[model samples]
Target chain A: MSLVEALRVSVTALATHKLRSLLTVLGIVIGISSVVSLMSIGQGSQERVLSRITAMGTNLLYVRPGASSEGRVRGAQGGAASLTLEDATALADPVNVPSVAAVAPQVQTFAQVVAAGQNVNTQIIGVTPDYQYVRNSPVADGDFISDRDVEARSMVVVLGATVADNLFQGGSPLGESVKINNRQFRVVGVLKRMGGTGFGLQDDVVLAPITTVQSRIMAQRTAQGGRTVSSINVQLAKGAKTEQATGEIAAILRQRHRLTGSDDFTITSQEETIAAQKEVTGTFTTFLGIIAGISLLVAGIGIMNIMLVSVAERTREIGIRKAVGAKRRDILMQFLMEATVLSLFGGGVGLLGGWGVSRFISGRTFSGQVLYTVVPPHILILAVAVAVATGLFFGIYPAARAARLNPIAALRYE
Target chain B: MITFSNVVKVYKMGSIEVPVLRGVSCTISKGEMVAIMGPSGSGKSTLMNIMGCLDQPTSGTYQLEGQEITRLKDDDLAGIRNKKIGFVFQTFNLLPWASALGNVELPLIYGGGVQRRRRALEALERVGVAHRARHRPSEISGGEQQRVAIARALVNNPSLILADEPTGNLDSRSSEEIVAIFRGLNREEGITIVLVTHERSIAENARRILHFRDGLFEGEEVMA
Candidate 1:
């Protein structure tokens, strides 16, 4: 018999048991939707992180306290005050490290700022004047902290977009005074609105003079009399190799610190940070795919189970067809094609549903910027291929059993 | 013409070898209407199965219209059944999901043709069930279902028609109606018909009859 004829017969057979066929298809629907939704969300977050990393100026390295432990444990840095102001000064010496073009040391602590009876708990960043150039972000309003403000220890602050929005209620706060933890500070500037990254929400911080933050709002207090900075932003000179400077900075810091078994700090550039984040997101995406794949397997099992039952129930019908000149392949094709159609239909619906759901949720961000969950064409193809392959893999044994049925015995089956 | 020499069918039921048709032989010429009769488990159904190409005989030579069919491959036997033989079961055996026209189109589909609807409708008309061609088997009467089954059987224009207790599932009135149709098909169309039944009244409708007991054919009688 022709394949077209077999497909028609299978469609008719499935139509007769419409509810059963739909129920069988539901398992695959749930499985494929999970895979599609998870993959798109993972891709969306990856793209967001990538853009944020690029937004932070290229060829800039961050020298933060605490070293990463090798092997099993993945630990977060910036836990220790091992980064001292002298280390930043030593790295800024052009005679010792000629590859360095600029350096911006920062100290940050969460502080409650009250302005015009409105209050907000936000990060207060203490940075040098070069932070505007190194971080590639300029103040949107008024003047930024200058060398005079740092030397004078003036209690002046530049608010992030969110902090300013919360404190000023949309009114101009350029010349306003806001209290930082019961201490008065004048608002000198407001940063432009940059979108939030998954980590280190740069648009939500309040910047102040470093000397002011060091003496005032410290999240961590030190017992030693020496001053400690949180981290230093080091920029490479134009056309200089980052790898060579990284080695030079490591050596300089090691010799300055006097003695070290493992270096007490970690230095990372934009590329290294992006690669690590990509690795983490890659592992997360793989984990999501595996979990979703298990459901597809379970759906396949459901298909096989239903197919076997169908074969058993249609024993007499198969026998009748065989007696009417249907070959083993005809019977086999009828059942196998039925399975393929079912799963493909389910997978198609699942793809659309997953896309709709992801798009719907992505629109709900507080920042109001649209984050699209990217569904690649290859993933669409892979989903369809997997559904078709699942049908073929699970449909074979039941179809073969139907094909091998003895016509005489099958006709006799009630 | 149909021919079989020393055809035997032995079935192994678990450890015991239960012999069904032991060295039986017979022949029925073309355009003849014949009936096979025996008690239950006497191998009448087994003989009919072999004649219909649904089962292979253990050791025998059976020829259908001068072609050797006894040892042919399973698929080849199916092809023979598609083009050369028509089969009717006692239960009618119509696919429940299909209409009468769809059921009648099965053999013609296997026989390879795109002119399905016209041919299927013509077959249904020939069996006097054309008016109900769109009805499912359960939606029709028992006699009408039997007629549809007959149409499905003859749709491919087979050289031989094998009916295994075709009227066994019907009431007396339906049984008589089905037998009359078979008799007319044989007399008017010159189609060869073979029937297996235990009922004496059903056997008497054929032109010739073969009596058997315990897998052995005793004798044959010509109906007047």
Candidate 2:
């Protein structure tokens, strides 16, 4: 028989028992819809994480102290205090690092602060004035520290938004003296609020001039009259490739550190961080997809069960068709067609259902970022392909059973 | 034309073998209307099944239009049945879910005919059930259902028709009408026909009647 006629016959047979057919299709619909929505949600979360990482700055690279290893026992990252303020100065020079735009060196420690009976222990960051622009933070009220403040070792300080709120309780703290480590320093400015999770703690810091922080707060210095810093934040020039700049910075650090087999610092670019996050979310998406695939397998078994029942219930009809000269191939095609139609129809509806579900879940705010589900074209194609394949895979046995029946015996079936 | 030469059919039930057709031989020419009459368990149905190519004989040869059918494969037999034979059952055997027109179109669908609806409608017209074509078997009377079955049988325009107890469930009036239609197909269309029935009055409608007893042909009577 022609395929079109066989399909018509299958459709008519299914139409005879409408409720039964729909119940059979429901399993597949649920399976495919879950797969689509879960995968899209997973992709959405991955996008959210990558966007958060890039929000800090794409062209900026962070240089931190590398792990210090002593005869196979390795200390944690940032344990080695090998980086110094002179290295930050060298990175800021355009002739030494051509792709360098600006550099800010930081020396940070947790310290207790007191102001008018209010005392809070918080992070104290020592940075050059260029930090205001390099870290993309600007003062909301009062002026930031001047470049001359670092040279003069001035005791001027800037409060983060959270510190300003805690110390003054919504009152202006500019020109007010706050004591850190039993030494008085006047607050000159308050940093703007940087709202986000994971990095939102940036709003709870106190900033001071690097020279003043080294001389008064922590009185620590490297041998040979050099000054130590915790980390250096380097901003790359526009149109500069991160890999090239990273290589150039590594070469300069290796030369300055002198006789180094390995560099004592680590350079991390924004793309690398995003790539690491994508790997995590990709595995999560695959895991969710595998879980959803189990339901599709169950749905396939359901199709097989329904197809078998249909073949048994229509044995007499099969006998009639066989008696009228239907070959085994014709009989097989008819039953197989019925199963494929059921699954494909279910898949089409399920795609729409899943899309609706994802859209409903989209635009929800989580941790200060808008979450959105992404349904790529390949996902839709893969879903439908799997549905059709499930039908065919589970359909073969029942269709073969129907096709192999003896016409006389089937005619005699009650 | 049809011919059978000492054909034997033995059915195996588990470990035991029971012979249903024991060396039966018969021949019916084109345009002849024949009937095989026997009581239950007398092998008349078995003989009809072999004649319809629904079962193969254990031994001996049967020829339809000079082709050796006993050795043909299942698919080849299906092809022969599709192109050269039709069947009518006593229960009407109409697909209960389909309209009379759809039932008539079934054989043409299997035969891969393109002009199926037109041919099915024509077949329904030939059986005088054209007005009832839109009704399903459940909606139609027993006589109309049987007519629809006959229309399905005639839709393929096979050279031979096989009827198995074609009127066993019908009233006398419907049975007579069915027999009249078979007689008309034989005389007017020159199509060969073979029917299985136990009623002597039903057997009398055929041009010849073959009596079956205990898996063998007992005798034959020619009608005037």
Candidate 3:
């Protein structure tokens, strides 16, 4: 029979049993929906991570003290006090590294910040004026810590947005005195509400001058009788060659630390770390997409089962058709058409369902916002291809059965 | 033309073999209207099945239109059946769900992209059931359903028509009407017809009669 005739017959057969056909195709629908939705979500998360990393300044780099190989400080037994405030000052000197924009030494300590009996455990960050530009910290309410604040060792701190909210109950925290480890420090400014970072919430801490933090709070001591800084935040000049800047910065750090082959400080660029994070996220999404594809296999099995049953049920009809002059290929094509139609219908419904689910989820949560942004078109096409392939693969057995039917016996069959 | 040479059909019940057609041999020429008459269990239906290519002889040479069809593959035999033969069953084996027009169109559909509706309507018109084409098999009388089946058989315009117990379930009036239609088709179109029946009156309408006693043709008589 011609393909048009075969399609007509198969469609008529399916229309005759609409409920059964619909129920059978539902399996494929669920399978395709799960695959498309999961892939969209994975793609969305990948984009989210990439965008978040890019948002933390393009030319920013970090220098931390001591090689903690295997989580053990290389030099000191307990904790390595390798980086010092003098090393940061040496790197900041334009004569040594003119490509450097700003270099800020930081010392972090956990302390209970108290204001009007409300106490919250928050990180106390010691930074200079340059820290704001390096970290992309925006002030939402009051001014950021200035150069004067760092020079005079001002007994003042800037509250991160969340810390301001927690300590003063949403009131203005600037000019209010908040005790850090029982030492009263007047609030100099309130920082903006920076969203979450890879490490934690960006707005969940208080900022202070590096001099005040080292001399008054924490009071951490090193055996060398030198003030210690945990890490140095470095910002490179716009359009400066990264390789040249790294080389110059390394020379300055080497001279300041008086080190040779084995350096105590680790200098890493934000770009390199972000690239690594993107690679990991990309791999994770691909793995998730593969796992979701398995459900499509199960759906294909369901289609195969239904097609086999349809062949069996329509044996007499097949016989009559063959007896009346239907070629074997005709019968085969008829069954194959029916199976393909079922799968295509299922795929269409699945696409709609997947899109609906993705849209709904994206409207509800923060992660969903990222998901909505990264809709993968290839995944949709793959889903449809899987559905069509399922039809072809599963339709074979039933089509063979129909094709191999003996015309005479089928006619003789009661 | 149909020819059977020492045809053998055996049935196995456990290990014992019961032969249905034991080396039966027969021949019928083109354009001949013949009926095979016998008592029940006389192997007449077995002969009809072999002649219709519904069953191959276990060990024998059968030829249709001078072609040795005995050793032909199932698909090759199906091709011959489709191109040359039409069948009308005793139960009127019309697809119950299809309308009279749909049942008649089935053969044309299987014939691969002919003017299905026109051929179907013409077949129904020939069977004198054109007005009842929209009625399903169950909605029509038994005689009407038989006419629909005959329309289905004739729609493909096969050269040979096989009718097995065509009037076995019909009343006398309906039986006469069906026999008249068969006689007219055979005489007017010169199409060869093979019928299987035990009724003497039905056997009398054929041009020749072959009688089966045990598992072979025992006697023959010229009827017209």
Winning model by lDDT: 2
Considering just the first chain, candidate 3 attains a TM-score of: 0.87
Instruction: Report clash pairs, candidate 3.
Output: none
Measured as a fraction from 0 to 1, the native contacts recovered by model 3 come to: 0.62
DockQ of each: 0.74, 0.75, 0.49
| Error in Å for residue B47 of model 1 | 0.3
Off by over 4 Å in 3: A67-79, A89-105, A155-158, A167-177, A182-201, A221-226, A234-255, A267-294, A363-375, A412-414, B5-25, B39-43, B54-61, B66-72, B213-215
Per-residue lDDT of model 3, residues B1-224, tens digit only? 98899999998889999999999988888888998899989888888888877678889899998999888876676677777888888888777778899988886776564678998899999999999999988899989889998888888787889999999999989998998888888999988899898788998999999999789888999975
Q: How well is candidate 2 docked (DockQ)?
A: 0.75
What is the C-alpha lDDT profile of model 2 across B1-224, one tens digit per residue?
Answer: 88999999899999999998889888889889999898999998888888889989999899999888999998888887788898899888889999999999988887878888899999999999999989999998998898999888888889999999999999999899999999999999999999999789999999899999999999999999
Clashes of each: 0, 0, 0
| lDDT for A333 (candidate 1) | 92
Poorest stretch of ten by lDDT in candidate 3 chain B: B106-115
Give RMSD to native, each candidate.
Answer: 4.3, 4.0, 4.1
**Tens-place lDDT digits, model 2, residues A1-414:** 888888898999989999989998998898899889888988888877776665555578889878877888989998777788899999999999999899998899989989978988999999997888777778888877788889998999999888888999999999999999999999999988775445424678999998788778876665445777888988899999899999999989989888358778899886787788999999999998999899999999999999999899999999998899899999999999999999999898888888888888888776876667898888899999998999999999999999999999998888
**DockQ (0 to 1) for model 3:** 0.49
